[model samples]
Target: MNIDDMESLDEETRKEIEELRRITPEKHGNAFFAQAQFNLGATFIKNGNIEEALEAFSNIQHLHSPKLYAAAQYHIGEIIESNGDIESALSIWRNINHSDNPEIYAAAQSYIGFVLFEKNDIEEALLVWGNITHADAPEQYVQAQFNIGICLSEKLNKEEALLAWSNITRLDDPELYAQAQYNIGSNLLERKHVEGALLSWHNIEKKDNSEAYAKAQLRIGNTLTEQGDYQGGLLAWCNVERLDDLEAYAKAQFKIASFLISFEYKQAAIKELQLIELMDDAEAYAKAQFNIGILLGKNSDIKGAVKAFRNIKYEYDSSAYGNAQYRIARILISNNDLTDYTSAKTCFELAREVFSYEARSYIRILELLEVPETKSFGLSLLDLLNIVLDIVDILTLNFSKYADEEKPFERKLAHYTSTYTSNLLLGNDKNNTRPSSFRLNTINNVNDPSEGQLLIRKLKDVKDNSFVPLAFDKKFHAFISCFTFNHDSLNQFRLYGKQDNKEASGMSLVFKKDFFQSKNLIGGISYLSIDNTLKITEAISNINVKESHDIQGQKIKNENDDQELVRRSVMRCVYLDPTSDYFHLAQRNRLTFFREFGDNIVIKNGTKQSQAEYEWGVYQEYIKIITEKFEVAYQILKTTYKEVETEINNVRFTLGSLKQKELAILVDEILLPLKYLIKHSAFREEQECRMIYITSIDRPEVTMEYGSFLYVEYEPSVKDHLDKIYIAPAALQHKRYFDNILKNVDVPVEVSGNVFR
Candidate 1:
């Protein structure tokens, strides 16, 4: 049977017939067997029995002969083409086209063109179809030309489309010729040749009873629209709608909306969009809602805009939903007249939940509302003012619970106040009060705790607009004592000395200076000089007999020793002068001492002897005489000896003399001790002797004139004796005794200050 006969079978019956053909034996030789099978497969293909037809062709391949194989392959290609397996069909056709069988080769070439045309390979398809130059070429070749024209027209190759279609127009089939004319109209429309498009489309006979006539009318209208004729465009779209296609209607509504929007008639555009909304397409509804929201927002009807935006669901319109929520929150914040903080907060919260990644601006809005000033605004406007207050109280209480944790309520309060103040300043609202400067003094009077109860009481009376004062009752003197000591040693020196040694010691002396009256030394001595000569004789005899003997022996046995002692004694006078003019005289004495000594009497003894005998005795005795005499003379001349003695003790007179401008006195008086003990409970070595001189030169004319004399002598035989003679001033002698004992005990110095206590 031929393909035309196979087309008459029902699809199921044709499949069964092809299946029977595959299993049944051939009635003739190989050539006839192949031919019969090929015919059977063609019939299956025409009836859409592709699977069964493939099986029939597989049986033909078993012959193994090239001529038979080529014929079988050609049949397979035709079946594959009918089945719409274009790639597989092309492969099979290529194999047959190379075969030696002329009939098989021609059939393969014709089928190849059909497959290529199906793939939209118009050029290759037309090339293959053109090889069939004979008038008797198969009907499949005629179909290939028509398909090529459709492909060319779709790609806007107008000339090529016309040529392919014109070739098919020569066919005898009236249906095929109508299709070619319709495709030529499409090609001219794509090229924007409106006159040619109308001509080609009008060439199709509407009476032919095909879909081509309706399509041609649509094309002609669309061509007019492409030339900037919107009325014509709508008419073409109306033609498609008249055909009762829902997709075309929806598309037409969308196109009208887009066109209106492009023309800057947004309101008119929205009306067209409403048509799409009525159509119930969810995507279109979402877009229409967003556009309406934008239009309303632009018109500043923010509430209406927000309602429109919120109409969109989150899933279908997340971006628009988030944007709409943000807009509502921002508008509410800016309006301020609404003052509905609750609604504002809700809007922002919903915005953050829906679009967490882009919610920072919305979050800032909520934060600003929570500030005390804005919250006050909400309290004023909100009908549920009590509930708002209750919530704030609860938050404040909860916030205080973590006040001592990582984030403190005090710090947060400070931060909030600052933020509120900054925002108020930025808004430049005159109703908002500027933040006041912090008044720390209101909290505590004295900057530190060292102030006494007097300051504390003052602090208690002081109050500020913010913060309460704290009163501290107990004295802070105890704390002060932690860093300070009574300094009993320093106090003793202050009280007993004729002139507070602090003044003489280069420290500020705080004493009632008026209590001790100054007096002329000459007048005092004159008043008490009924026995001045006797007093001098007594002072000279008071020098130790042994010390006097040693002095004489040192002077007679060594001229150098004698001269050095004289030089040092004279040099001591320089320190006595407040003006220090005697320094030149002292230097001359020093040179005389060095020249006379000249390495004799052992140079080592010079320093030791000067420090011990001469420095401590004559030098110190001269200073002591001056100090004592001055005190005594002052008392005798001013008050009386008994009255002065009551105020001061340990005074003795040494020498006195008169100068041109002033009367000078050398006196013996006890000064602070310069004594230290051997440490570690260890006695000083027998060869080590410690000596201290408790006297100084006193010159009222100059400050810092009085100083203690100290000397240490190391001599095994006289070491103990040296200690006894090295008495300290009556004021600080005990301190020296304790310091010596403690040092000998090897107690650490850190504990020395507390040792006596």
Candidate 2:
């Protein structure tokens, strides 16, 4: 109630009470009169008339001893404490020794202890608080136990402090319990028992005290960061829910920004710092603006960075304002623009004026920045800011530097230019040179005919050699440059040879024994290398337009035995159909060639056939190279087959008959040559003996003839006639389907044992 309201009521009540005290009949009852006086004291106390209440209660003590007297004394002590007379309050409470009023006695003793604690008398406070053992005063007992822990912890008696906190067994008083636990955690953290400390903090219930809970979460993040688990620390900080404490929240956000900057996430760091500006905290807002200026300058947003620095008001944070001005000067000086030098000098002078006491120290550091030896210590931007913030009081920097804080981030330049200082740079160190590889030019030179002759002689005359299995060919011998062998059950292998020199780097070939026609072999080959030298007058695509004219030019060059012509290998595609006479004469021809003295097979043989698509697609590629204008050596392949010509049809037939069904009808016409040569070999051991026969001449009736064959039929009007057909394996279906599950439920099938075994 207002003082006027209480005075108005007190004046009328006082006159009536005085008249009743003077005119009351003493014979009727003095007991009734005493009760009426005691009630009057309570009314005075409620009206905030402390002196009058004391007088009324003191008069009752003379006439009679009642519970009202004890209540009045308790309130009198409270009024003295509220009025700032703590000593007087303590004395009054200490004299209230009424044994009959256990509640008042217990509360007065607790109040005396609290006052002693406020006065910094730790030993006396602890003793007085420990004396409150009233069973009816659970709240007082809990508060006393908590305060005792705080006193002991402050004195560095950690064990004793924790024991005192543990004595508070009251679960109903959540605020006191949480406070005690928080104190215990703080003590444990001081002792370097990090895990135990975090456990104790995590035990605090957030539902009880939200401010304390937020603090615990922030501490967890700081502790993790000190331990060098940076990512883990960030996760803990992110979980800190905003509470009543704006200062703690700002601190948490600032810490998050520092961590992000250290990890090179500069943009994210800037955003985290900017969050502080939304809060009402002037100090946090100024610090955030200073950091934002540094980050903007790093990003090369020069004007934006200057504006951010200039926006830092001196009244909010004098240190931040001074530091921002210093940065503005540093940026302007580094910019080296003639127009900005005058402004830069002005900024530096203003900064000095703001920090006059430390002005010389800053200037000395700036001079040291010019010395290469002192400047190249490689301190990061954040580190420089931290050192400046230190020894400056405007910034309340409380966190102590731990071991991880000692490590600074790597320095980095703002721009990637050659004419920059070596003060800061960021990137992993790597060697400029490429990885080392074995040199092979000296012994494997194609120009030396003696080397070629030696390789052929060794391959034909090796006596004690068993054919090394293909699977065991991963390792190679230096002497034997190239070798090949066929699988035992599959005779679809050919051994090709080549001089392993730089000249043969781009040339490739492929061969496969025809599975359908066991007595015949069909294959294709082409050369797709470009001969582009500065000497050539015409563009590469226009080099060999007329087939015969190009062939003649190549022949003339070969006849002259030019160095370039000597290294060029023959590019040809030789196929033997069953109806052709060469199929039966191949074996006899081979014997005759070997019988008539030794054959120079080294000139014809090359690397073993690994990818059939390379050789089979060469014809289609030759057509593509000239038609689509791909650069290739003009002398390699003279013929440029038209799309509808017989040569392209033949090439398509050979590739479509392979076991691979996906490439049956190559979709992209432009990919005929380049795509074919670049495809990885789909060769596997199980597929070695398999082959397919495809025909597009006519749509025939489907029929199965062999034990492992399946025939398919296509109507005449079918748009996508799939011509490739391979025989199915025993006990297997070629059709594909997905297993359906009802109600969109997933069913797992567990398969046991290895299939291969």
Candidate 3:
């Protein structure tokens, strides 16, 4: 009876046969004979000697020993089935005596159910499996229960199915038990009993059935997620990694990778997705490739991103291919390399079919930023910047010359500067001097940090999905000059800066408003309160922008009311040549699709580019920089027109579906003058009127004052437009010298002496 230590079935069976032989048939009345036959048959089956096993089992008879006889009969059926006689095996199993040997009888019934189910006899199989119980045979009983659950689940009897599956225990049959638990959880989830479903899945015994165990973990993760317990779901999914089931493991890893992104664990998330690429599931593998490519691009791993994108099969996922191609082109251009532009162009051509409008936008941008060695393709906005600044300074505030009789046509403005710099404006030099020109400083060097950009930061309502970064890559250029006119007294002059010495004496150059108005310059400053809260509705993308928090009790001006804001500025002055039906955006205003750190354009990392994380400032950079720009270039370059007008000779344009507010946000973000014009409320008392000159500063005639700052000198006729120049209190000491300097002039040069000093 202690045969547990036996090394082989042959040895154990031989010892049993010898002992049974010793109990002669005369003493045991043929019962020992039946027992010896059963042991021989079992040893034959173990050795895979089917014919010998059949012969041995057939010798056992129910009259001699009923239990041994029924067991031998069951062994014969197994041999018949293994030998391919399914009908014979089922016939033999069906005739087993249940009363004499319940274990063998249960096994026979279990086989019958399997054969019927395999033959599509669902009703017959369910009936057979439903009759089995633990009282008959524990192992066979659990197998029957598991099958019954599956059959009932398919038959729409969910409650019955759950009951059948729940009755099975790991102690009876671990593999079957695990599968049964998985089915119970799945059925419960289908019935919308989420908590019960998750509980069952979580309780799955992983014994040797890793497939079912892995599946259970996946279900638990999903169930928790559906209940809004994302952390719980992620943790559950993470548990699947312990198993060897490739499909389940890949699915869990994908979910975990995506979750890690929200927490900014980029490298860890990328590592997870990378593992999924080698896993068994085709769908998860493809998605992992795409997301990995995206994450790599964001992390600035260009080579790795490109390789990941290229690994995706176009036949597997064409949509992902197109999107990936579009990004590949962008990453190539983001490096600002001309050699990469060719490859980028090829990628765009491939992507154009899918991203018709967006791909075309970037293609046009490449043309504008084409290598200078080739035919020039830059936004020659130095002239345009100068022209738009004049247009805005001279004509903008007039609102098309408001025709209101009550409004004064004649206005006066003032320009405050140091006495030493003042002399340069009155000098005789042509381009270098200003009776001929006035100086324009770069917008960045201005006192207000918000110069050239004020609208985007304060905007609240934006459809981030529509965002496109302006494709124009060359350094966006804006030059600005500040002035205060409404209050041009000594106090105003002093507010500009302190008088360093005699040369730095702050002089307020009072001029007739008619002179500037005649010269196409305006006289008004729009001071905005940046201190007021900006209603942030859209997520700022990759473009660098300062971050601010939301708190109560702060005045919210642009609180979802986005329509009133204006987007047009000198930065994007569209020369709508209606005749050609083609025009370019104001390239000189130094505007961008979205900008950060003053120079880093974030178009490559826009939402449209499929960047999932939100740690950027450019809320919307969706620059269809179209007919106002690159669309014109797209039509010119494609030359793929049929009878329509997209031929190389003709011009075609693209205008994206931009809502007024969204478009305003996109354009306002890059408009260079708004950054200068919209000063903070803190400086409201200065009554400032800024003159912004947006242009190419790459080769500017910029003068550095006393080794302090750089400024571009422009020649404006200040003498002709002169009203009267006011002498500051410090300059009053040199009144006679000032009078002698302007003795030939008819205009007054008065002094405002501060008696308090």
RMSD in angstroms, all models? 48.1, 33.6, 28.9
Winner by TM-score between candidate 3 and candidate 1: 3
Candidate order, lDDT descending: 3, 2, 1
Least accurate stretch of 10 residues (summed lDDT) in model 2? 540-549
Query: Can you give the lDDT of residue 396 in candidate 3?
Result: 38
User: Deviation in angstroms for 137 in model 3?
Assistant: 1.2
Runs of candidate 3 exceeding 4 Å displacement? 1-28, 205-213, 263-268, 275-283, 313-757
Worst 10 residues of 3 by lDDT: 539-548
Whole-model lDDT, candidate 3? 0.55
Q: Candidate 3 at 521: error in angstroms?
A: 52
Badly placed stretches (over 4 Å) of model 2 are 1-7, 10-38, 62-67, 80-88, 134-136, 168-172, 228-232, 241-243, 278-280, 313-319, 337-757
Against the true structure, candidate 2 has what lDDT? 0.42
Candidate 1 lands at a TM-score of 0.31
lDDT of 3 at 744: 46
C-alpha lDDT of residue 452 in model 2: 19
Best TM-score goes to which candidate? 3
Record all residue pairs in model 2 with backbone atoms less than 3 Å apart, i.e. clashing. 411-425, 412-425, 496-606, 497-605, 497-606, 529-633, 621-673
Candidate 1's C-alpha runs over 4 A off are 1-75, 78-91, 95-230, 242-247, 257-272, 277-286, 289-757
